[model samples]
Target: MGSTADNVTKGSCICGALRYEYTGDPAMTALCHCLSCRKIGAGSTTFTLAIPSPNFHFTSPSSSSSSSPGSTHKNFTVTHESGIRLKTHFCGECGTFVAKEGAGENEFPGLMIVNAGTVDGEGVFEKLAPPQAELWVKHRVGWEGERHGLMQCAGFPDGL
Candidate 1:
């Protein structure tokens, strides 16, 4: 059994093409109602697990750097298929969406945001802390009711 405080957790995408070992505490986890999220997630809202950069880990060993003690693992790679440089990685054979990185690299400092749905098992969502806030609510399709007691926002927050 994995505890909520577990340092590591495994996740993959739909086709299992990608695999990831996420570490450290997630900065935030939220259900996004943006159009982009809905299109990618295929759901009314997209659940994301945001974490600091240092906590993000990739299982694939990159040719750029050899593995060593205390060194980071390169389990996945960011693809530029859509010309937007979406940092999505997955296993080659299974095509599973593992984890995403580099969301708040420049402004927020060390931060990597990932989708919570990528985590394996049914209880992963139960283990995660409730979302602190909602983003892109202006594009929300319909009322999703109350979640975690946090009111949904119409758009990006003033600061965030």
Candidate 2:
């Protein structure tokens, strides 16, 4: 699917303390139903858009510095069942997760998994990139059911 703004997509934290934008199309889009994602999202699933690292940029000024993208966000690193370490960036002010990046020898080394829900603009969530698959469906909630017709994987998608 294409982005809401031609080849650009914008997003921010719940409190608008952090803003970000990415150019070009997402590498992939999917719904993650893994237990860790569920707990981190505080929901049944999380819609994510994977964009190339070079294409993603933080537009908001850092809470502590004007030049760096490091300060003001909390980074939490979690080791997945596959032994892949993923670091998630959460807004320091609102505590809303914005994106995640894989660490050291991970499959998606140059891609950032952006939280689709954080995307800005009216109807952006509905109009932005559509999920191409559902991941970790084995951990999906019983009542949520499945998103029929989409590629569903019990664990990680094949071929990365």
Q: Largest lDDT belongs to which candidate?
A: 2
| Candidate 1 global lDDT | 0.57
lDDT of candidate 2 over 15-124, digit per residue (tens): 98888888988888899998778777889999988899999987775524422444556678888777788888788777899988886765567888899888888777
Runs with alpha carbons beyond 4 Å of true place in candidate 1: 1-6, 15-17, 61-86, 90-95, 102-109, 146-148, 158-160
Instruction: Indicate the TM-score of model 2.
Output: 0.87
Q: What TM-score would every model get versus the actual structure?
A: 0.67, 0.87
**Candidate 1: count of backbone clashes, pairs at least 3 residues apart or interchain:** 20
Tens digit per residue, CA lDDT, model 1, 94-119:
44444544332333345556778777
lDDT of 1 at 28: 72
- How far off is residue 98 in model 2, in Å? 0.5
Q: Which ten contiguous residues of candidate 2 have the minimum total lDDT?
A: 61-70
lDDT of 2 at 136: 94
